[model samples]
Target: MFPSSRLRRQRKAISFPAGWQIIPIAGKYWTSGAADGLGGWRWTGNLEANFDDFTKWGVGQPDSDMVKQRVALNFQSLAAVFWESEDDTMSMRYICEVEDSGTPTSPQPTVTTTTPTTTTPTTTPPPVNECNARKALFIVLESSSHVGSANFQLGKQFAADLSRAFTGLSTSKLGFLTYALIYHVRVHLHNSDSPEEIVSDILSAAYEGHSTRNTAEGMLAAKLQLETYSSGNPMHMVVLTNGVSASPSTTKHIADLANLVGIRTYAIGVSMPDSADQELLNIAGQYSDRVFKTDWARLDTILGSVVNKVCNS
Candidate 1:
């Protein structure tokens, strides 16, 4: 069964047979849940392909409603290949690619190697500790009006403490950003400075309360930052907020796309209601451990656990 949980299949180049196409059972076909800018459409079948390998959008297709109409594909008639977006739950039929596993091949001849007679001392160091391994982490804090100035300050302190905890890890890079009316990239992912400097930057940032919570745009910014500056390191993001987004569906869709691109995201909901916590789950990619809820005063108490998960999870 195709697992819906996987936002996108393993990404790689896929080869299709001649005249290969997806024939709709009735009206339209269900294709990938890939929109335009969140890393172009891709083949998610058993065989894989590049991000843009299967893109062929119809005229004015793949519309702005990225959350609902995310599936992209083409029609079978007229020798046409114009992809279009459709709802994923629409009971439409599509093709599935399955790899052959029954064939057997001859085994290769065994070879042996001899140990070197001379020995030399090497200067290579041991592997970096997993908890301190190289990675790119982006922290996004919500600075909307719902998050009062006191709680916003608490969020800043929490971010500062978190950055300080990961300081001194030469390879691990951390950045900071805040979201409300607009998202600000206070620290870039490529900032190669001391953790103390990063902490200072975070603590010094001004939290001008915004009238709206544009978490989706903030997450998209974080995703772009990772894509541009992660240098192929493990990408992780932590979002701390107390209010629901002005566009929750967009926020959730962006989170889904981020997860598709291998961005591990975590969410912290500070003194949020049940409805808002649901949004936090979406931001966390619906992973329980990745979603933490607490009052603003106790936000720092979960620092240890968040750090542990960031390092080990």
Candidate 2:
């Protein structure tokens, strides 16, 4: 492939005994037979040797017409006795070697190399928190005028009962919020609130006396307030409503947002109207089992289940 002296040196190193090595054509020598006399080497190696070394061709061999492309070697007339490669396939001979020139040749060496590999250190991550235990809970009571005087009073009574039942909670950290036409926080987290304080605040809470009840915006307000308190502290909400809020879709949307931010909501509907039970179910999310529809009197019966659901969430 190049003008390398090593190739010429290797070629000139050919050596064999007196008769050298003549391989018979019928079984060995390359020939075209040219059944149709097309021009080209019979074998690929011969093509590599010299498709047609014009300078080494016999007098008129491979002549202009050039149709006959085969070869034959007659050692008796060493040089200038070459024939067309395709002359004849049956009567041809191949040259494997010639008499030794007695010139000493050098041996080549083989080299093997091994590369070094590198090792990278693996890193471990911190453990994940499943939030299966309660940390801080925010009570979101429906104080809207939509609940009216009687319904709001019943809601307050139910909340006070539920709050007292949260005694010795898995976590002492607790909070409180109320929403009607708007949302308001009655207690912030981390104050080490006692069960008595939780019940008192719920019972004493007043109704909003407003017609608007966009529960979703109220939930978002609770989320923002909880975020301000701390991060990674499991959050839970207990919403007491007598009916579906005016903006139910907005209520569901913010409930979903609260869920995405790791806050679990447990909606309680006491004496709810019509499809309001399922509406509360939607707001409660995966804690749908925590949703309740009962009169203020039976509200105490499910307080234990509520605490368990919140703690084991």
Error of 1 at 201 (Å): 0.4
Q: Would you give me the overall lDDT of model 1? A: 0.70
**Number of the top candidate by TM-score?**
1
Q: Clashes in model 1: which pairs?
A: 56-83
What RMSD does each model have against the real structure? 21.0, 38.9
lDDT of 2 by residue, 9-31 (tens): 65667555565575533333433
| Prediction 2 TM-score vs. true | 0.52
The digit string of per-residue lDDT tens for model 1 on 216-263 reads 767877877787788878999999988888777778888998989899
Deviation from native of the Cα of residue 88 in model 1, angstroms:
34
Give all TM-scores, in the order shown: 0.59, 0.52
| Ten contiguous residues with the weakest lDDT in model 2 | 119-128
What is the total number of backbone clashes in candidate 2? 7
